[model samples]
Target: MKTGVEKLTDVMAHFLGHTAIRLPDDVIAKLEELRDKEDHPLAKVIYRTMFRNQRLAEELQRPSCQDTGVSQYWVRCGTAFPYINELEDLLREATIQATFETPLRHNSVETFDEYNTGKNVGKGTPTVWWDIIPHSDQCEIYTYLSGGGCSLPGCATVLMPGEGYEGIVKFVMDRMTSYGLNACPPLLIGIGVGTSVETAALNSKKALMRPVDSHSDNPRAAKMEKLLEDGINALGLGPQGMGGHYSVMGVHIENTARHPSVIGCALNVGCWSHRRGHIIFDKDLNFTTDTHSHFVYEEK
Candidate 1:
């Protein structure tokens, strides 16, 4: 008989494997909109190629990109959940199983030791972040694949109190101009502002998990998202950075109260592929997924 952790691991492994080949519906919609909006001939061709790549990946049940990327799991767990103690181990085992079953690119290598784990699991590989919710018996997990190109452009800074919001705009514009093109354009930009660099950096990546069309609830933050989106699109980096009218699909900002003396900001960019999935598990481990609703598992 399988333990609860083992059952959860099986579900998670299937989720990760399916997520690799399938582009979420939201992403496909955004790409199609960009394809129609683009006027440049080369940009149109690039968009078509992207569509073809996604179709082939899904049909063949293969990864869309050779770089499957490092896995990152963002978890919101109910304090009353039964498997809370085993969640981390279950996630790690799931990632390891998915690495081979999905045949993910060997992207995990030990730092300093400098050896590829081949399997995506290693110390700190498939990093997990947890948020505990009180008085509930369910858990929500968001899985993100952070590809090397997209992850390369992530930047964080601590702005002096006097630098204010303009400083944020300047920092983002500078970072995007310097490195955004390399990540594959028509990118989704997530900005996080908090009291410290580490807090800001994590929030920045979390921001990317939001729906593509969504904006910050705060009015000022929503305004900033618009301004950044417009400024970035003006850069003319275009689709795949090949030169087009649109450089980014959207801009999203997530922020929290910050210290009076400093404002820490971070940027995380998602490429056109934008691979992520969400699953919710109840106390009994009954699960439903928003991102992989179409996936049907074969009995082992």
Candidate 2:
């Protein structure tokens, strides 16, 4: 029988070996809506590229983006869970192998040497965020493949306390005007507002993992979501920075109370093919797998 660690390793290897979750119906609907409204020929071309990429990824069983991104994991750990040792290494190894087998574009760069790891693992590769909960024996892990083109446009700023909500909107607006096109229009935009830069940046990344077009539970944040979504769509960035009726696929805002003097906020955007998936495993290794373009039960 496979131990929990072996089970974990198996899943990770399998996940990296395949593309997760097909674009859901709503996502496909939104893309269709944009395609019909898109006006610029170039923008239309970009949209076509995205569509074609998705098809090829499915047909060929390959990643849509060569830059499979810096693999990021948001892990919720159960206190009662066993086999904690070597989890990180297993993840790193999975990424290394996936990079080779899947041929994920070599994205890791050595800052000082300017050399690509080509293997996708380096000093601190495959960033993992942990949330340890009360007594339990199950864990849920969300995996995200954040591409460079989309992540490059991420923005953060600390607004003065007096500026209030309006400042946040302006910051987002300015970022879009400057780099939204390059990040890929019709993007999934995540906004985080909190006490410091780090919190804001982290929350911003978390926001992208949320279901496309879902709003935050906080009433105020939900309102901001609607406002930002409307404002961005008005930009008509269409797909791929071409002009259209919609510039963003969705807008998610995550927030936390900040110090009285600080109004820190950050923005992260995901391109049309925003790649992510979630899996939950029980103590016996019974798990709900929601990656590789399907929802199924898996066991190792």
Residue 219, candidate 1: alpha-carbon lDDT: 94
TM-score of decoy 1: 0.97
Q: Which 10 consecutive residues of model 2 have the lowest summed lDDT?
A: 291-300
- 45-93 in candidate 2: lDDT tens per residue? 8778878878887788777766678887888878887744566788888
Candidate 1 lDDT (Cα, 0 to 1): 0.90
Per-residue error for 215 in candidate 1, Å, reads 0.8
**What TM-score would each prediction reach against the true structure?**
0.97, 0.91
Candidate 1 clashes: the total is 0
Model 2 quality (TM-score): 0.91
lDDT of 1 by residue, 135-250 (tens): 98999999998899999889999999999999999999999999998898889999999989999998899999998888999998999999999999999999889999988889
The lDDT leader among the candidates is 1
- CA lDDT of 6 in candidate 1? 83
